[model samples]
Target: MATDQHLTEHTTAREELLKGHVLHVVRDTVRLPDGASATREYVLHPGAVAIVPLLDDGRIVLERQYRHPTRQVHVEIPAGKLDAGEGALACGQRELLEETGYVAREWAYAFTMYPTVAYSDEAIEIWFARGLEHRGARLDEGEFLDVIAATPEEFLGWVREGKVNDAKTLASALWIQNVLAGTWKLDWQAPPDQP
Candidate 1:
């Protein structure tokens, strides 16, 4: 790959467009690598975490929820935006329990993904979890979804059929597939005590 300095854009000025409850929009004037000035607008996200919870029976937890933007029900791994100053692993554990009522004894850092590079700075950190014990889900106010379990084969089949097409979920499928095939590995750990 070429050096980044040759391709980097330097921000000269910035303007706030909209500050929504969850999204912060901004436009910036930048000097391109070729010394050309341009305007760029993008969303500033707080980042998020996604969990691939594995069960002893060889199944993984998933969710079916209707997203307003897409206006379609999506099958996704448990995920949520990070709380202010929250760590990736902490957010993952919190989301898994709050959404699926499952707690894992073992956790592993899988990978991170940027779903939208051109229009948003949203990063989702993905984690793998196992040794699950179901207590009860404590969904946040105004949150509703159906929790389901699927085997790796079934999930991959959905991916091929275009049923599971959400970017974050798809990215996770890639990692999970490789991990199952022994092409990738994860460092599993026990959960730390909550503060």
Candidate 2:
């Protein structure tokens, strides 16, 4: 009988499997609630932030880049992993500028989601940004991508057609749709040190 009071798995042993630049893998042995033991493998992530950048003209910013693992070009909202001790909002701002050459005067923290709950501890913070101003992009060396601008409806259509299947992008597009429709509310705020 797995009840709320005794359902938590106890970690009996843990081993670091691999430590890469972006991904850290670990294997754990756990004692189950029913007194059974099992091994679980998962990735340790630093977490990341994804931004839904809404321009004043009602278009949203996106990116199409080649993903090595999938070997496919994926359309995604501007996002990046959090640097050590970096705030999510700052990471969002940085990614937006570097990836899309845009900046937003107003920003909002939308929601947090876990994309691979079964196998990874990766959390993505979704952010909403508006009052945008365009600047020249400063892409990282060797970073190649095409910037795309589209309305929420267009993005939703892509999602329906299986063209935008990246988990974080799908979530961001949904957030954009509802937020623009007034069904979802965001606590929008001015960028720091600004009115």
Worst 10 residues of 1 by lDDT: 186-195
lDDT on C-alpha atoms for all candidate structures: 0.93, 0.90
What TM-score, over all chains together, does every model reach? 0.97, 0.94
Candidate 1 positional error at 3, Å:
2.2
Candidate maximizing TM-score: 1
Q: Write the per-residue lDDT of candidate 2 for residues 6-83, one digit (tens) a residue.
A: 878899999999999887999999999999999999999999999999888898889999999999999999999999
Candidate 1 per-residue lDDT, tens place, 42-121, comes to 99999999999999998989999999999999999999999999988888888999999998999999988999999999
| Total colliding residue pairs, candidate 1 | 0
| Highest-scoring model, lDDT | 1
Off by over 4 Å in 1: none
